[model samples]
Target: MSSRPLEPKDPGLSFGGGARAVLPLTIAVAGFGISYGVLARSAGFPPLAAVVMSATTFAGSAQFASASILEGGGAVASAVTAAVLLNARYGPIGVTVAPVIEGGFWRRFLIAQLVVDESWAIAHRGDGRFDLRRLIGAGLVLYAAWTSSTAVGALGGEFLGDPNVLGLDAAFPALFLALLWPQLRNARAIAAALLGAGIASTLIPVAPPGVPIVAASVACLVGLRR
Candidate 1:
């Protein structure tokens, strides 16, 4: 009797299916990246900074916030504060997906860096059978797509001189709306969102850059658990 799973490793395996599944996610991520690039470039950030962020953080919202703070001539403390607030969601993602990662600490850390929302959705779709190769492959595709798109958009912004008339400002928000739409599938999520929003709106005036997000996240968690 073999204890192994039904599928075994094969060097000849193709990522066509995974690629297809990830295409929409990649395109969506790319769009956000492009938006970020445009905004950052227009804000007077050198192209290299935009590329560095997309390559390093690979997080759309965090990168956007960081760029905004920096572009506003805010100090390093402000930039880090914004980034930390934006990236707090990753801790939850790591907690939820820890069971699926069967690797050492280094591998886990690497994978965690790639555990953005879309990547997590794609990874979890594998039904507890996806190997590391698949996960890594998906992450790489997303990373490349995101970074390269940022570069392209940065260059485009440089050429265009401004994003106002081009309507690039709305791109990231539109993407966020689309990303968030799927999560509102259930009554629990809907309720949580409403509850969180109500609370956060009340707190927004008093809260710092990230307190609202944290407060809302906590409210949603409590709502979901209850």
Candidate 2:
């Protein structure tokens, strides 16, 4: 008997599956969002402005860095510079995922807005190809979680007291480590990580907040040379 040909997966099903796969990570993202909301409020942002920043920026690290800089009396230019540096990783991420994104100009442009580290990682199927449905789905879920959590945190910031007192300050770093740990399976990755860490740690005291992260991230070039 002849076997039937395989059918393409339904986009909705793929989207749902992707969302489910990323749900666990989204929990951590929510926690980070809440922390960011608290931090933003403490940094002198109005609750609405804090929520708006999270909605528009959708970058926890950059948002946090900018808020911290602003809180420390840094100029707006300095905060913007830090945010730009911290978000530079998205350039590579966008390039890597660009070919797999299916759409017209506007569609691609909208999708590009969702290309954060978490969605990028989840969209990569480990075969140099991306699952677009998963990418979009995961992005939607994460975006909603992040933005809503930010709103909740910002509104409740008054009652949350010190975010540090509740240890929320550790959530973002912990989530990032959890994400990075899975990708360090090779010597090159390990070496790059160590180099980046060393560089950032050494520069932390002297360089501006996000500058060290950007400088250390250059270690990723080591992988390209291999």
Candidate number of the best TM-score = 2
Candidate 1, lDDT over the whole model: 0.67
Once superposed on the true structure, which residue ranges of model 1 sit more than 4 Å away at CA? 1-18, 42-44, 125-137, 159-210, 219-226
Using Cα atoms with residue i matched to residue i, what is each candidate's TM-score against the true structure? 0.67, 0.75
Candidate 2 achieves a global lDDT of 0.77
Per-residue lDDT for 1-226 in model 2, tens only?
A: 0011112454433778668767877767777788788888889999999989988889888999999999998999989988988888687678778897876999999988887777766666543457787788889998999999899888884565454565666755665566466556778878888999999999989976666766886787776874
Task: Output the worst ten-in-a-row residue range by lDDT, candidate 1.
Answer: 1-10
Clashes of 2: 0
lDDT of each: 0.67, 0.77
* RMSD in order of candidates: 6.8, 6.0
| C-alpha root-mean-square deviation, candidate 1 | 6.8
- The TM-score between candidate 1 and the true structure equals 0.67
